[model samples]
Target: MAHKEPPSPLLLVRGNNRRVAILVISILSLLAMFFLTFSPHLAIRHCGHGEQQRSMATETMSFSSGNTNDGGVSRRQARFTDLNDLTATSQAARNEEHVLILTPLKNAEAYLPRYFEMVNRLQYPHHLISLGFLVSDTTDRTVQLLQDRADELLNRDPPDDDSSSNNTRYHSVSIFEKDFDFELPEDRRHEFEMQPLRRSFMARARNYLLSAALKDEHAWVLWLDVDVIDYPASILTDLQSIDVDVVVPNCLRQTDENESMGYDKNNWMETQQSLDMQKKLDPDYVLLEGYFEFLTGRYLMVDMPTHLGKLDKVPLDGVGATFTLVKAKVHREGANFPPFAFQHQVETEGFAKMAKAMGFGVYGLPSYLIYHIMNS
Candidate 1:
């Protein structure tokens, strides 16, 4: 009966209070552990810190998952973007244009191979070059050779670039095999005493070539002598870059190491003012054509404006066509090679005089020299 007695109320309440106290202490201990373990990590994230480490982790994940389809597609897209950039850059480098090269070869059989060499050496785009030949009264195989070569050049690309897509440029040949023989002896034919007749003949020949070769679509006309032995491959581009109305290079004839002298008398220039002054001093004064300084045998080389720093272009009363770059407009606007006496100047000199009267500038490069074939 004593063992079965009911428990006291105060004892029960005390037991409940002790259990509650133990529960509160356990909860406070759990909260303190959470703050201590995670507070540093949270602070670091909120303070914008450890960004480099995060980036490294992201890159590591990307590399580890690189075998995925998404990674492969991204890599392919980046490669395509690079290829597109390269193609755009290369396409911008093709600076193509139209140009005409005119040559008159009567007995140029010997020079045919060399002329082809010059053509091969030309740096201009092959598609942009239109070659024209004027062959008349030729006793040699010049006509046949020129025709065969022109056909070959037109039908196929140049020897160097087989993949070139530029073969549309047409080439032409004109043969006037008529005999234009003079009754004079061979020695007297090229004599200085008979210069007017010789120059007039030459002028007539030049005019015929110009009339036959000119094309309105051609922006420029390069009068190149087949006998030029030495010249830069960029000669055309160099002169064109000057952006002048008309320009000529210094043509030189080399005899010996010490005996070389300037050639192409037409390049030797005098201002109109000086020529007029000379005329005033002597009304009948004649400017001897092709005249040069004594002892040196070179034309009076004078200073002119610098074209590309390496080349200087002097204003001139006359110009030589041996290496002349004449604008097509100069001919289209009424300039031609005068065969008759123009102030006693004939042939190319007369052409210079004619061009000047027509308001065209004639310039010469003193330092930029092109060599002529010996005895040509």
Candidate 2:
């Protein structure tokens, strides 16, 4: 048999090298594990499944959640296309059109969580919509809490598949943050002393957000404040039924004197005495064409593009930012929150007036009400 050529020494040496390679790999893997256990970013990066996976998960959850609970009531599972099935720019815009309720906030820690939870519990497709959160560089834990809740929303299960319950539209929540210009002192806010021109900073923030939200090409941008809580899942349903450019969810504010009333403008005030009287009635109240019970960025809706047209022509005044929806197309055309908007000057108001000049009508949804908790 020729003694099988006596196993080559080179082969033995190669075998030894393989063992050393394996040993080095094993050591490095252990080191990686050590870091992963202690470092969040490192763990997410090295694991190669950070934001990308979360985004995918969001899509999948949303897809599976389709019609699972029609109107927050359990129902049969409905067939649905995956997010990948969407094609064309308009398709993306349509997908985003679902609705984006933005909560413009500054120093709103105590009330932010409830606001987010209400959105989360809504009986509509939460996954179909995105939440734009405009936050001031906060001094408290509001931002951190938002970040945490955002993560939790992404990880949450799709609405229960059980057919017996009426809890359908609840899906995962997605919150996006854009840059906020927080140059205004809290003392100068509309709820405090009405410094007409000085309070423009908040408007700037709202305008910048409108620009950012339109960039996403959302169908509608729903604006809300951080403190107001009483929003029903059916709020969007009511707004979507209308063809108007903007839909404001009018609500009643529980006043210090224990009274509640409609929160939209009944008529424009011609005299300072009337305005002063209304202000005395409710310090933050601004008399418009009609008195709206709630408008202070608590919950307003806009069709981005149409609203953008209005912003381009002049400053739209007296329309509360809260619970309002605007068309996405109009918003994109208005120039995404152009710089110098928060000048405590006229830039922000200019956009609103521009919207009015462009002939965008603002409608009020009195049937829908959001509770306003004025903390300012």
Candidate 3:
């Protein structure tokens, strides 16, 4: 062993310590560099993935349903979006066209489930639409059912998905309930007195519902009758594209012959003759629908120059609000279902007159049909 002399222990220790320090520093530096570089890279990748997930989700998605059947008809998509905020903000968000589905619920328990099912099935993003219910004078489990649904909605988490930003929960599920001492024979609302006692109260009820349900006037108000049983899922999309001050989709009911009839009592093209005649009638003359059933027939036909190749916005004098879409400004400008007569019209008709007076275009979609549940 020609080691000239055993290297001094101190020297050896110092050399070893120096190499150890260098190695430790190198390892720590490598770790720091890796963390600084790769950590950000990982985080950026994660964020990008999240964003892509949301984008892709909204881009490619349909409904998931098939629980309830209508007389043995197997359903394809869930009748309603249920609470999922799917289609939270579709293309309609371009001009900030969100809608408040305002419903005045009265004795709607039996139909609530089906109603919601149909509503959820609407081909619009539930998130962009706030559901407002003014439950007045309901005796059945309508309020309770609404409460249960509200609780479920409140507790439901934003659906777990790669993309759920816009499709998050709804904007609001407001349910304002109170008792109105008024009573209309559940089946015969039209049969009862149609004057200050009946028609005016109906207007008041509608107005109250509007006041309570409308949350500011940033979005259009779609006064959807709770009794509507069937409607196109794309109803929202179709109506929004009409681009009018106010719009009403012709609602139809199935007659015993299995044919259809215009069910909207207030939906009509006011003729000057009808107008003058209406003026001559008793001040409390109730506006009756279906008088020209045989002449005009029922069923709206796609018969005018309109948009989307499947919708028409016909000028109207007065139409029903069975499924009316009123611009928020119309109400913000004091156009509402008046409790008193307005130009020989009352309630929804009066609302139309007010809108007209305000120079707001009131259009009707005749060909586009929505079904209403009768008795059942």
Model 3 lDDT, full chain set = 0.70
CA shift of 12, model 2, Å: 68
What would the per-residue lDDT of candidate 1 be over residues 1-376, giving only the tens digit for each residue? 4577677543465656877867887999999999998897555333245776796555444553223365356532111111121111111115444567878767789988988777667766666677777776677899889878877777764556545533433444334433456344446754556666776777777787788777545667888888888899888788887767788887878886645666676676665555555555433323544433212122444333323555666777777778788877787777888777675567787888888898888888887878887673
Q: Candidate 3, residues 281-317: lDDT per residue as tens digits? A: 7675455444442223222332332234357567887
Q: Provide the overall lDDT of each model, using Cα atoms, as 2-decimal numbers.
A: 0.67, 0.52, 0.70
**Model 1 TM-score, all chains together:** 0.64
Q: In model 1, what is the error at residue 199, expressed in angstroms? A: 0.8
Q: How close is candidate 3 to the true structure, as a TM-score?
A: 0.67
Top-scoring candidate (lDDT): 3
TM, every model: 0.64, 0.53, 0.67
Candidate 2 vs candidate 3: the TM-score winner is 3
* lDDT per residue as tens, model 2, 1-376: 5566776544565757977867887999999998887686334333345777886566555654334655589765533444443222323323434666766666678887688667756655555666667676567776778888777666655556634433334233444454454556666554423444444555567765665554332466666667666777666655665656654655556677766544433201124444344444443322222214433222222212222322232122435555666665446456222223221113323344445556765455443456676444
**For model 3, what is the error of residue 11's alpha carbon versus the real structure, in angstroms, after optimal superposition?**
90
